[model samples]
Target: MRTLIVTEFISLDGVIDSPGGGSHPRAGWTFKDVPFVEEAYEIKGREQLEAGAMLIGRVSYDEFAPVWPSMDDFAEYNEMPKYVVSSTLSNPEWHNTHVLRSLDDVAKLKQGDGAPILVHGSATLAQGLAAAGLVDRYHLLVFPILLGDGKRLFGSGDPHTRLDLVECEAYSNGVIKQVFDVVR
Candidate 1:
């Protein structure tokens, strides 16, 4: 069976909406200074190379499909199969991209034998997966900042999902990377 790993770069105050620039005022907060340590790059590279495919939501796919294909750095990410979960999206323009109709399809995908499926910057999808007990693990890179007002990683009504810390690393720039396994 393959693991579905949901990853995000969240703020101290729990905001994970836009680590990259977006509509939020603190959208580009993560880029204020380089927070990545050398080891961070190594870890990310390994994750990218080893993952069999990426599973993203419609919003993330809309954002990434336009850029990743043109970047040489994301070659590995682009080459791997991409699965976008959406009800509205019918035709995906990006090469090697597939559409998953619903979260139920994702649940089925988790039962298949393959490399781990990676989910990045898909807040809505992550929330649904977490609520449905479909996520196997969470890879969170928490930056030292407080975005007091923004869409948070966990919504107020979201059901509690307990996680077991599997790994943690603090970078020189105060960025903390933590990997947690969903307590099933």
Candidate 2:
């Protein structure tokens, strides 16, 4: 069986929405308060190198598909087999993109052979996967600032899930890389 890993750049208060630019009042929070630390983002590069495929929600797919294809920084992601969980998305224009309708489909994908499937910027999807006990790991870069109101990475009503810390590092920019293995 393959592992399913959910990765996010989350805030101190657990907010994961709009780390990049968006319509939110505090959108683009990742770059605003924190100074750029190349070392802080090394995990991202490693994730691309290690991931066999990429999985994301419809919202993230929509946000990424439009621009990631043209970004050299995301070249690996652009070329990888990408799965978007969405019932409404009939056509995906991105290269090697596939649509999976539900979390059951995600579970089936996890049973297939390959390197771990990496999930990025999919808060709702991640929550669902976590609640369903489908997520096997979490790679979180916790920023030091707090945005009290926003969509968070973990939901309130989700069933309790235990995690064992696999690795952790605090960057000079105050962004901490926390890698956790979801306890089965």
Candidate 3:
């Protein structure tokens, strides 16, 4: 079975919205408060190297499609197969992109063979995957600052899910990398 990994740059208060610049008031918080530490982002490089495919929600696709393709830093992701979950998205212009309609489809994809499907910014999709128990693992870079109001990585009323810590590291810049496997 292919592993489904959800990765995010999250604030200490659990906010996962707009770590990169967007319309959110606290948008670009990741870059604003945290000093750039090349070593702190090593997990991102590792994720790109390990991921065989990318799975994301429509919103994230909309946010990333126009930018990621041209970014040299995301070349691996640009070339890899990407699956976007959305009923409304009929056509995807991103290279090697496919549309999956529902979480049921996501579950089916998880049954296929591959290195792993890495999920980037897809808060709603991640929540659904967690609630449905489709997510296999999580790679979180927890930033030290707190953004009191914003969409969070985990939502309320979700089914109880257990996680086992696989790895963790604290950086000098106060960013922490944590890898957790969803315990089944």
Candidate 4:
């Protein structure tokens, strides 16, 4: 079976809502005004190229589509196969992008052939995938900030799922990168 990795740039408090100044209320909580280190960018660049396909939620898609397409830094992501999990959005203007209407569609995509499906910045979809027991791995990039009120990576309406830590690393800037495999 292919691996489905969910990658995230979250805060110390597990807030993954808007690490990139997204419209979400939790926006700018991660590194808010601070600039990222060169190592962080390098790591992200590597992850972007490593994934066979990328999956994202509607909110994330909206926030990213407009920018990534124009970003010279994320050329890999712009060219990769992208799957957007959206319920209401009918038309997506991104290249190599497809819309998944339901959880069933997501499962079907996961079953198909390709490189591992890497999910990024889609908390709602992540919750659903986690609850449905579809995720195979998680790559969490934990930043060094804390936000008391923000959308969490997991909790609230999500089902209980245990994760086994497969690997972990800590950067000098206090960025903790943890890779977890689903315990199913």
Tens-digit per-residue lDDT, 1-184, candidate 4: 5578888888888888778777667577556544566676555777777878889988888889889999988888889889898878877899999988998998888888877888988788888889888899988888887777777888787777788998788877778888899897
User: In angstroms, how far off is 156's CA in candidate 1?
Assistant: 1.8
> TM-scores of the models, in the given order?
0.93, 0.98, 0.98, 0.91
lDDT measured at residue 20 in model 2 versus the true structure, 0 to 100: 90
User: Any idea what lDDT model 4 has?
Assistant: 0.82
Judge candidate 3 against the unseen true structure and give its global Cα lDDT, from 0 to 1: 0.94
Off-target runs (Cα >4 Å) in candidate 1 are 33-36
Ranking of all candidate structures by their lDDT, best first: 3, 2, 1, 4
Model 1 residue 80 CA deviation in Å: 0.9
Better model by lDDT: candidate 2 vs candidate 4 = 2
Per-residue CA lDDT of model 2 for 63-166, tens digit only, reads 99888999999999988899999999987999999999999999999999999899998789989998889989999999999899988889999888889999
Which pairs of residues collide in model 4? Answer: none
Span of ten consecutive residues with least summed lDDT in model 4:
29-38
lDDT tens readout by residue for model 3, 1-184: 9999999999999999999977679899999989988999999999999999999989999999999999999999999999999999987999999999999999999999988999989789999999999989999999999899988899997789889999999999999999999999
Q: Local distance difference test, per candidate?
A: 0.84, 0.92, 0.94, 0.82
Query: What tens digits encode model 1's per-residue C-alpha lDDT throughout 1-184?
Result: 8998887888888888877766788677778644556665455677898899999988888888998899998899998889999999988999999999998998888889999999988778888887888888888888888879987778777788788999999888888889999887
TM-score: model 1 vs. ground truth: 0.93
Q: Which pairs of residues collide in model 3?
A: none
